[model samples]
Target: MDNGRAAMNLAVLLALIVSLLFAQQPKQVVVTGAVPDAAGGSLTITGENFGFVPFVTLNLVPLTIDAVGGNRIVAVAPIKSMPAGTYVLTVSYGPSPQETGSFQLVLGDANDSRSQSSSDVPAPSISGASTDAAARVADRVITVADVDREWQRRDPAGYLGLIRQLYDNRRRIVDVMVADELLAREAASRGLTTEALLKEEIPKRTITMPESAVVSLYQSLGDLTRGATLEQMKPALRAWLERISEPEVAKMNYVEELMKVSARAEVFLAPPRVQVDRTPQDATLGSDSAPVVLVAFGDLVSASYARFAQAFSKLTETFDGRVRLVFKNLPLVGPGSIAAAEAAQCANARGRFWQYHNAVVLPPGAVDAVRLKQAAADAGLDRAAFDACVERRQYQSVIKDAIDEAARYGIKSVPSFLVNGRLAPDPPPFLPPFDFLKRVVEEELSRQTRKP
Candidate 1:
């Protein structure tokens, strides 16, 4: 009886170990590649760990799932009306991480039946004063494309700024529309009017401003109060604060929570991007082989650039070896700006660009002959050689070229940036926050890793 009991105990121990090992297996979701259907309007994705039914999206737009299996998924591509371009495809399963891949989809005639690799789509004819032309200067037609090219060449910065503004406005409108629709649907489901639903929800989420907060805000206002005492301003201040913070803030937070928990929404509308060139003569930081190369066009004496310089240094430290910074001089402030840029370049020639940059370019003050010499001396440069180099205006042509390049690239403002040939989005006021820059670098690194 004792031997039988011992054998049963050993058998139970073995079974428990096997169950634990199976439970510890890692979950994986990988989208390897996709093949467009020969008949068009659909695609097959081959991958692993696709659950019974997986959600698929192309550029954040959902697709109808036709079929699904553990390693293959068939989905209808809604690219019949979309413009011809490459799009990102993603797949997600319950509790498994989403995987992304890219594929090219081309638009063609409805009757034309060809394989996915066939390129039989005919180009649009542009003979004899095209209707799409921006202007017809007495038979010399200027197409819309021609106008766009000219605009980008002459005022690249302004062109990009306009594009960004348009995108922002469109995005904001879309967000409001989506939120409204979501609220309407949710209210209807709960048998309540939209206004009534908001009335009920917003109040619960709103928090009243504390007395201490009001006092602190009053103290910070200082001269903005127009010599009014705290007691006199208290009611106005509290009312203003409550008006800005209560219903609106609460409603926004409630919508955000609903977006995360109930519905999954993703925005894939990308900003306009421009290709920026790099040269061998550029003053640079970090390794040449770094995954991200950030090119900054700036005026040396500009206060905005000086403010950004601090954030730039922090970015380098945070990203470490993953990012490289290439500085180009725009020198738009004045002659003193030009002189300072030249002096920095002179220091670059002596292998002291960063040291001179810290002393001269990163400081907020007037740039003059004395200040230039003082900065060179502070950077431990040979004063005589540096002075001669600056007197000759050695890098004036280099600075001129940089300014011309900036104009060509539409970089009219100080502290413009490009990461790996893609233009960074314009920031509010002076410069982008450090966290925003960090996200850009991390995204570039991830993209590089995803490349074939």
Candidate 2:
């Protein structure tokens, strides 16, 4: 009887080992490439292991697949599913349930505003002038493509801002270009050339710079005069001061003017927004230039987050890409909570924070050491390193600092938030959390719009 029992136990153990081995076999799937287009356009996804069917999402928003092939997916992303910004595009196939990666969608020429030049720029009226005069004076619609072409024709420095992300150089350049175009269109509408209108308007607004200030600026620049008379530097100094003071010109309502005139002109407009922290250490999603930022403080084990995880996502979607979110850790529960926080940070280090967050933290389930490891695996984290990170408590101080910061703010709740540095007030109990958050966001947006 003892021998029979031993054999049965050995057989059971062998079966378990085989099952584990089969489960560990890698999923045969790979997203080889993507032919991305404008935000609302179709994105062709080329990949393997899609099987006969697949599912897709852009930041958890379901996508409508127009056509599906063995290794291709032609899908129509919703109208605003991806505004001009970045997103995590996820695809699910038989071998891979939810394979995810990042992709940036930029608005294309279909939204081009470029059409015609100002008719007031010495153009011939239909009532008079020769054929050559009529052709020379014709309206010129400006496409962003045309703007780009003109940019290329102009100095490389003027165009560098468009392609380069180094500085907000693009904003500076685009502002000038858009304003110039808008001004031209406005001038034409008033039956005057842009140059003529600017000549009249600028002189009235130009400030008289103090002589002492101009001299100081010249000396600070190590005398670009290069042994030329101080008189020579005076003009340059005055010019510099004048240009700096012209920000008022750039701040005009160019977009409104363009819309009023129905002129085709593409301009990169800046969002009116504020931010307290712009660090990647605090998890951030969406464009850096987004107008509103929602900062939240919570422990990974907070049950409160579970109630509003979907709500938070909905709030983000409802706002389009205008609002960016930042998540900071504040461990308040226990050792399990602390460990989970550290594990989350580790996953964040591996760029899997969102996945781990959904699977482990916000999911409606109790967490333990075993559960934490399983969550890490489900989040597609590197298990051995994740285990090491959790054991070592690598992000312990990070979580502690965040918790201390939350305390300083007089926040004792697990799901506290600071919307653009203003503590979110207790929202009305009648509305859902998502609606409350949306109201908070809309209020902030309205406030920004009201600002000069």
Candidate 3:
């Protein structure tokens, strides 16, 4: 009995091992290659495992075969079943199975047709223009082509509108160049152009960009399109929008430079209108006699204000006790912005000013009322009290005081920084020419040390 039982167990184990070994074998099939639909009228998939009579199926679309050839098989991808994208091609014959790799259904262009030759569609060429005009036209063409090429490579089917824009921009540049040359020629023939005036006027470009004009342009371009998608006109839209804002950008750049021209520019030295009697300061801040007080007038909504906070934090760390950083809130974004200010003040009242400030002034989109209240609650402020304070606009007076002070000092924007009683030059990121505050503080420190 024992011998018979052992024999049965060995036979069962052998059958199990054989089943596992067969399962480990790869699927009995091979796929040579798949040609895209455009390469030929039909996709040719070549491979073998056909049992002298191979049966094939493509996504449940069955195929019948009359004969099978050695190491190769041909199957036509169904035109109606497959759209323009990649799809799998499968073939099966009972136990013997094969699956072809991805077959691409490409948009058929003239170039892909077998009857067409490479020489038929010649590459775009630039000719028949004056040297400078030709060069400008060429640059414009290249810019349009490059942008289209990139967008199409990723999203071919969706870029028809972009291609149209490229053509339109090319036409506009061509017209502009032709007209410019004609004007130059006429001016020369009539002797109406002076050397100095021409030189000065050529470089001095005045582009007026009214805010309303940009809003109108953006609207006309379907920025507020009625349907599901905004049209893709990025290349032209970017250049035109930048062009429209040239005057305002230039004016701001000029103002920033003027403020940095001399050590005495004094951006923050607005004429004082009121005198408040000084009350003796508290003992909480160690010694309240710091020589330099850097006041940052900031708004939560404005982009520049966040940048100001970062640079101010760095400067405060660098100067330590010599500089005491004071932040005054403007909170002009909306109700949301005001609520944020109130929340911060509530945290400050609980001796968690720095923690709350850091949390709120974090990268934009990272702050909301929930997170603000959470930070306050974590900082040991009563959640209910903080909630009530924010909802009731308890710190409106605080924001108002900051605004009143700013108005008195002729300040109109957030990120307006005062370093030792002078307004710091608020240059845009691209043209941050100089740091006047740092210079003044360094100069004053040097002067005092020299006197001793």
The candidate that wins on TM-score is: 1
Ranking by TM-score: 1, 2, 3
lDDT of 2 by residue, 39-157 (tens): 65777878776545555654334467888888788878654444454444546542222232223334444444454566667866423322222222248544445545565666443
* C-alpha RMSD of each candidate structure in angstroms: 23.9, 27.7, 23.0
**Candidate 2 or 1, higher TM-score:** 1
- lDDT of candidate 1 over 1-452, digit per residue (tens): 99999999999999999999987664566777887764677878997866676766554345778988668999997555665454556565542222222332334443444424455667554333424777778879888778777887777778777776777777778889878877887789889999999989898999875665556556545455556566545544454445554556689788877777656654455546666777655888887788899888877677667656667788988888889999988888888888888888899989998888888756667656777788998999999999999889888898888888887666777777888866676552111346557877887776666523
lDDT of 2 at 135: 28
TM-score of 2: 0.39
- List clash counts for every candidate, in order: 2, 10, 1
lDDT (C-alpha) at residue 5 in model 2: 100
For model 2, what is the alpha-carbon lDDT of residue 413?
73
Error of model 3, residue 439, in angstroms: 5.6
Give Cα-based local distance difference scores for all models: 0.71, 0.63, 0.50
Q: Is candidate 1 or candidate 3 better by TM-score?
A: 1
TM-score of 3: 0.36
